[model samples]
Target: MADITTPDLPHSRHWRFSLDIEAIGWLILDRAETSTNTLSQEVLSELEQLMDPIESLAASEQMRGLVMLSDKDNGFAAGADISEFDDIAEPEVLRAALERTHRLFARLEQLSVPTAAGIHGFCLGGGLELALACHYRIAVDDDATRIGFPEVKLGIFPGFGGTGRSIRQAGPVDAMQMMLSGRNLRATQAKRIGIVDKLVRHRDTLRWAGRKAVLEKRRAKAAGLTERAAAMGPVRGYTARKMREETEKKVRPEHYPAPFALIDLFEKYGDDPLAMIGHESDAFIPLMNSDTAANLRRIFFLTEDLKKQRQRGSSFKRVHVVGAGVMGGDIAAWCALRGMAVTLQDLNMERIKPALDRARKLFQKRLKKRHLVDTAMLRLEPDPSGRGVARADVIIEAVLEDLEIKRNVFADVEEQAKPDAILATNTSSIELERIAEGLKDPGRLIGLHFFNPVAQLPLVEVVRSEHNSDEAVARGASFALAIAKSPVVVRSKPGFLVNRVLMPYMLGAVERVEKGESKELLDAAAVAFGMPMGPIELMDMVGLDVGKSVAQELGHDVPEGSQFNELVSAGKLGRKSGEGFYRWEDGKAVKGEVPEHADLQGLGRELVVPLVDATEAAVADGVVESPEKADIGVVLGTGFAPFRGGPLKARADGKV
Candidate 1:
């Protein structure tokens, strides 16, 4: 066995940072008792303490340069620990903490020996921030390695010098976007942006990263990494300000404190990397303690929790898509693109070939981006008559949302399908219970309500009808995992989850139009509130005919105010018909005044209240048993926003 464990360190503050008496300065950063290390207060404090050891080692002059490496081998640190911020007491406390972290990071940058960071795995947020302070950064070119400043999603900016450092290192535009959007960058992309000094594949990672640091330290040019920090000065300030404004566009409640706090801190010290870190303390404590922050953090944890819960230690190798329409073709493409073998089936050659063509073009685009390989072609097979169903383990049915159409198809597909193959249905405004009614293997009939344009929509509602066995739900969840879709479980109901929640909102929008509020005015209010698309525009995009049919079918069991009927009757079905609440011509929705024959523009908002109140009361009055039940219908079946928490929350808040 080889020797393990670092010498001269029982533990050093937050972690044990020690230097060995090697020819080159080798600093070992090992934080114990964690699968992935992160920069917490204790960890940051320990890092500050590491400075004393460094000065002491430097005095003896035993080493020429420093090579940074993790002793734990658990993987590079995954940025800062998010939970600590969730419970912080106050803004001042956060600011003070940031100040302390800034001081430590500043001292590390000033180290006499040129330093290099050997990074692997997730090098994100504060972790990437720390590496940027070093003179050189070398990383393993592993597909698993991820690097980025993903603080925007947290409703904050990179506080520990990441904003300025990334901007200076990658140039103003790249760094500004990195902070504002929080999108993670992989190895190749990271190298393109000048964040990575060298990216070596695994075989040569250790040797290359180590030797490169030594060579860089020996070069006179390596000393100038700090000098170039001021290269894009005016542009840097402009980009930072522009990014702040762009972020404010998305931050709700207008008066929310986080964005303004960031703008203030960056305004004061963004150009000075060392000074900027200290400013973080002020924003951190206040944002950490806010109720909005609390809610957002809870939502964040819920998202990660859902992903893990759905994954549940299971996987899928092969999946099947039935029907060759838009939904089926997209589902097949998504699955095959995500590395699962897909067998797509339709009634005949013409329909099957079209779907196959769809999947082929989708993968070809992926291939162009190097996101897919040749083997992906072999994984996707289209059949006119369910040719490959026997080899498929999961079959997603995307036939039209007609009861007879689906049940009839399932009856024959059932005979040809494998015993354990999961049967997933992509039916909108249809009850999962009724679809499972006539199946011999009803236990396998699970609902997978993927939104239209399957490849783009992030949500995937997994519906488990009463007849569906737990195994079927689990298998469907596994298939979603294999395809990398965000999955949520929902109850079996018409318009199962998302659609159920949306019906109320659409009804409210139409009611507003009836009540003298301009449709455009109401749409403006929705935009100001942070919806991806306004209700009226969305209704038009969905088409009046389809919207009317779905509303009539779904609203039949609920209260009145079926809003789409009049619009459909007047031949205004939305984008499909080129006219709706607004007229569409030349591929744009030109805002229109209330129609002459359909004038409800003088009614009161009471009309709007009735639809929302009736919906909430319907839930309480046995229309839906509970908030959870009604919510499932809204979320999965209806396409409601997940961040809102559900219809019950919206109802209780008088926002329904």
Candidate 2:
């Protein structure tokens, strides 16, 4: 409102306040910090500071209605600024903060006239909670505009009266699912489910949201959004983050206090929306303060950062796989998903079927989701005897790890491939330079390593050898991206980044088992240490044979006192062979007879320490531990727990 601005208040967020004599007052909720306004602590404080404006105006009969809108192109408000949660201390402190926020929202709600939140662009978490606090909400119908409380993912939930408010407005069923799943709702879907009072197209937003606010003459009779959100489904949703807490329950059971504190705030203070909202504001203290959350957040940002990273300047458009076994099938499927034409080849049909089948399933899943067209599967083709090798821009050799076999595949694939084609090996154990030596044009050779079940894992290892050209490295990375994977370039060393670190860790784990450390204790301790799977459990997934092979690749001098290789020789091939450190029955891992302890490092980080502090201290100045090598080996070699960010990072974090 033109008449509403405090003469002394600074306009730091680039917001302008003005009142319209036309009866509908206007306030542009703009923030200059970024392109969008995040409902940060400062924003909540500002919102509280401004509440007196409407109350004072109404008391003096200066304004009849108010329209809260964002001047920015794609947002109303993106909820509570999560950055504030970075250093929260205690649950009580968090609760106090929520109480303060509740007071702010309550003040805004008590206006005698009417209030409306005009939402667009990422109406998520606290942002949507703010809108729910308003008397009425109008959203612009556009793909960019979405509504959801995604706090559950971070082991938190909408603390700003969102669970209660949305439940009241949308009723129990929809409200519970919305918060629990933290699923997004488009404006159209929002209207259908009664989550939004009204949906307006982008052009009609101001007019509709403003008119709807002034038109909403009736005072909210019962508890609105928060009340409804708490009462949904058989789950009997509470004013707390019950919907979201379900995930936390399964994910962090041992760390009950972390998730429970969040739920406790909601259950304890939710009755009065104002009180619960106040409680909500302070929730960040315990939620953010906990070490569990800290670790989870660290992991979250770590992997998320990888996803956002790109291969600098290079772009890969085509990829070719030189084998069609389970690994190659997964590789091809991943390529197709990321908008790449993948030519999967095998020496014969025996190997070809597995790769083709894997790709077929991957594409079928996409078809079900409608993310890829049903016709996209036609792009995948099989080449027995390396027929498509020459036409490919990048060729990945997914053949066995056998030295002679890998060398032979390289020799044949090189002969068939174009002069400029980047030849890569999916070999997990073989040294890249040695295999490249088998090629005439060694400069064209590199390692394009993918994990088994490539469609799922996000990592790919791009091995750059001395002979490899920058062009080859660039394309290898591009192909990794083309397959929708995170490619971390590593040095041309045996076992690459992940395994190099992992060898010692595994040897340590096996040694621990061999040393009479109870399997259950080791697993429990590791789990408590935040590893997704314990060492022995991991060995089962990695296939005893694969694990032994990688260990052997690490050489006889790799680590002393681990009998895993001996076990592999004794017929334990891990999950596939149904025996390793554990037994596999019906696709699930079960503890096997405790093998004799083979303890290597004893306790703590002594077992698997970081080789060198600086890259210069290690093998070379620029060696990267391959996430691809780590992920694939973990997935294929030992089932290292995909969501846990693999053993390389885990070992580094655990060891260092």
Candidate 3:
């Protein structure tokens, strides 16, 4: 009675390959109506016409090895479908579709017999360049797997043949700092950084251990004679002049030309895996028509269409949280590190044991087991009795921004929650209708704001309030995409959309340091106008009295009688009182001299055109519905400049 009509596909005419298993010739990518497998230039032209009859069955011996699985239960592809980069917006049809995906990964690296891949979930970017032209890969000891080549977070690089098979198997400074810090790793750190070649421990034994490491011809695992003598030759010219002086001190190779063209095409093709696959298909065909990789592939299809329009099909078991501080004990230890049973109340049991010792030091720096931070502190309970907000199913309220103490803590969380729970709020500058006035069902409240060390920023915002309810803004955008974060639904104004487009670029860098300018020429003109920390050293690392009380709680203006109230009346609260406007010492930021006629590109366009006109006036005042969710809420809540994709596509490409 529970069969659900859809099980006839062992191989009904190879929809994205399916050879099954004649001693592991599995192939099977399975992309029909997709739930993950990506590489779509029509699935790399039907995987190059199904690898020409499996390369004529490995040239007649009827294939002894080949795996590349993924009938998607998790995901093995997740790459190459920047919605087919709008049908190759011509850089010679995106370098002839990246030279037909490098002649189908150089015909699966000249497969004569053994070839592998397996992976379990998210083998990213051209699916880790088809598991590095397969000769082995394996993966699957799942915490939902992960391997990499995150195409430099979509501003592009790793244009298939993943920068010459991750610098010929993990050399060139840990494969160019894992493709210039796009960072995925975790399949036991991609098998200790040789980008995985075996970690199986059952995902149905990754296609029988990737066909027993391709009929025991294993090979693929190189780089260690001290990572091939620290990338060889004159220590590869002092590691390509210290990765081009640390990628031009935070990217400015003419505004992000794919991580300085993947460190100048691997310092001009050293370790030549076929000249780094023709300089990664001529630097990914004009960086796939760069407007910074089409605004970082339109913020990777708007955070994958806001996780399918914020699904509210319910599933957030328990979760209480009410103010244990440090953003409610890191949002109750990131909802007990995502499995959620959380609780964390806090009438101070030493503030709920330092949010259970900062959620057991964030699950001992992201779980590789200290008993999975004791199974995420056995789902972090610590209530100190508000009776876990009447058996919470979502209560949040990380209190103390004050609007009558968050309307008397939402009238005692609408008198102890759960009448179909959900009452969110982590208020990063209030106004979800002023914390839903005196809430007794301000349509079950909402806002889920979360962003300050809430397990290291991935922007939550959810907001919504005209007294919420479209089922409480899809249950606060389904508990901020069920703890993984990225939410962005916005609209309850006053500093809602990323602190109202970052309180006019931090009160216009404190009115250019009270009109004299030099916080080292406005933090080196916001790291030469790309900004990953500059507006007065991000308001002295977010504490010039918490950026002047969020620019006077977002009403903004802050000009008259200034030097920002004489550096907050001389306590100089920044870097925790080390001193504001530069003087932190051993903890860095030591700025001083900049009056060599400090125009600094007109003070970085007067602190980036009022943060690109307050993100096109927050998509023209609906507070966020387009200009791609106010440029993915100021590029994931005020880090902005994801190669200038936010701030209304850097003010509609005039690049602010």
**RMSD each, Å:** 5.1, 6.7, 20.3
Model 3 lDDT tens row, 1-656: 01112222333332444444354466667777767788787766777766777777678775676777778887788877777687786888778778878888889888888888888878887888887898778787778878777777777777777787777787778778888888888788878778786787778877667767777878686666777665566676677778889877767777777887777777677566578777777777777677877777777778778888556468778888777877888888888888888878768688788778877878998885888889889888888777888888888878777778777878887986779888877877777776677666686788788777677788898888786767778777877887888887888777777777777877777776677756777767766777777777777777777677777887665554677767877889777678887778776777767656445555575677887887787778888877887787778777777766777667666756
Model 1 earns a TM-score of 0.83
Assess the local accuracy of residue 25 in candidate 1 as a C-alpha lDDT between 0 and 100.
57
Q: Which stretch of 10 consecutive residues in model 2 shows the poorest summed lDDT?
A: 610-619
Ranking by TM-score: 1, 2, 3
| Of candidates 3 and 1, the better by lDDT | 3
lDDT of 3: 0.76
- Stretches of model 1 off by over 4 angstroms after superposition: 1-6, 12-21, 24-35, 45-51, 69-75, 218-271, 283-285, 311-313, 352-378, 514-517, 556-563, 566-572, 576-578, 583-588, 592-656
Clashing pairs in 3: none
Q: So what's the TM-score on candidate 3?
A: 0.36
TM-score versus the correct structure, for each prediction:
0.83, 0.71, 0.36
Ordered by lDDT, highest first, the candidates read 3, 1, 2
Q: After superposition, how far is residue 92 of candidate 3 from its true place, in Å?
A: 36
Find the candidate with the highest TM-score and give its number: 1
